[model samples]
Target: TDTPVWVKGSGAASDYLALHDRPSITELIATKKAAEVAYKSSSLTAKNIDLAEVHDCFTIAELLATEDLGFADKGDGGNFASQERGLRNNGDVTINSSGGLKSKGHPLGATGTGQVVEIFKQLRGDVEKGRQVDDAEVGLTHNVGGSGATCAVHIFGRSPND
Candidate 1:
């Protein structure tokens, strides 16, 4: 454990169980609520994150997550995706460096753990060269369930003080 990745903050939240009951179709309120708590606890905003692993059960889910997680403007996730702004080595904050849930099939309960492992390796500079994120000092993982009714966010950093 020479290269340690610290868990700077963690947050979880839940909203209405039924999707139809939520206020917005394009946003996951649970994610926003969870992110707010995580950011406050970590004293780090979305702008401080260098990389993020988000739940992408569907193509649109990724887009929504980007917006809900504050990576993009509320309606700009499409542009973000089209511009490859979330792609590794392509943007300010790399999204899904592990190829995400789409590329790496959703393993039921193991998805979030897989994300943490990806960030760990990336922060430690131990991932495959092509897959590694350059100097990733901070990372985030977003997980959601129950059709966006529930969410969990965790932030990590290479330094304890970060």
Candidate 2:
């Protein structure tokens, strides 16, 4: 059975510059911190992740997430996404294979739980055939709470019950 480790982070109100106003446009600072804690707690690294469900509220959000989660270097998010490193279910870290919030549709309060559900299914090999990440032993879920002010990151894997 695979155990889980989690972490969370919140940026300060003073850090609330416009989304476009941040010094590091390519960075998601809260995500970075949250991911750091999760990995530290779990004693794993980005390369160990098999798949992930991230808040893709926008295309840009997904891009920044690639870097924030340590799957790619800063400023190389787009490249990471395009170069078969962050693709669906087979890349270094399969990203948003549940079609993301864009195609899967976001249901406000249920979004975070929804992400967990997808990860739960994925780890169980319960996702659709073409979408399943083979040997999805380590799954990560990233839920952002509005405008990056707060965020939660969790690492999961197979459970004894499953």
Candidate 3:
């Protein structure tokens, strides 16, 4: 069974401060901690992972994702982005090659599952259009809503026999 945790960072200033001084920092730390927990709990390892479909809602989100996903350290995600390694197909961790909300149309009602559809296609080699990851066996998705009010993270894989 998968247990999803939703961390919010909105509402009155009191609500915001109660969680943390800065939502971004809280999100960053929480996301990183979540990744550490997930990575350690699962039998799957990062090197064995092939690709990811993260919520690069803003350009900054993309940078944060690299860190959150354990592909890059806290401050290194931006540097990874600068090298074109942050989210390219051949990058260290192929991320949001789907163009994310940046290019992919974000239909509010379907955005979360939409990211899954993209990852499913990518992992199964079912995508032939722009930004398809080559032979991706494992993939991940990160979804969030309204400045971290709601978030979901998922990991997917393609079995050899599938």
Q: Which stretches of candidate 3 lie over 4 Å from their true place?
A: 1-27, 86-91, 160-162
C-alpha root-mean-square deviation, candidate 1: 1.4
Model 2 regions more than 4 Å off: 1-23, 84-91, 159-162
Tens-digit per-residue lDDT, 1-162, candidate 1: 889999999999999988788888879999999999999999999999999999999999999999999999989998887774544545478989999998887998888999999988889999997788888999999999989999999999999998
lDDT of 3 by residue, 18-127 (tens): 33555555355445544554455444545655677777778888887777677777778888777755434464678677778768666676776888787777766678
The numbered model that scores best in lDDT is 1
- Per-model TM-score versus the true fold: 0.95, 0.81, 0.72
Indicate the worst ten consecutive residues by lDDT in candidate 2.
Answer: 5-14
Model 1 clashing residue pairs (backbone): none
Q: Report lDDT per candidate.
A: 0.91, 0.75, 0.62
Arranged by lDDT, best first: 1, 2, 3
Query: Which candidate would rank higher by lDDT, 1 or 3?
Result: 1
By TM-score, the candidates rank as 1, 2, 3
CA displacement after TM-score superposition, residue 62 of candidate 2 (Å): 0.4
Could you give the C-alpha RMSD of every candidate to the true structure, in order shown?
1.4, 4.4, 7.1
Q: Which 10-residue window of candidate 1 scores lowest in summed lDDT?
A: 83-92
**TM-score of predicted structure 2:** 0.81
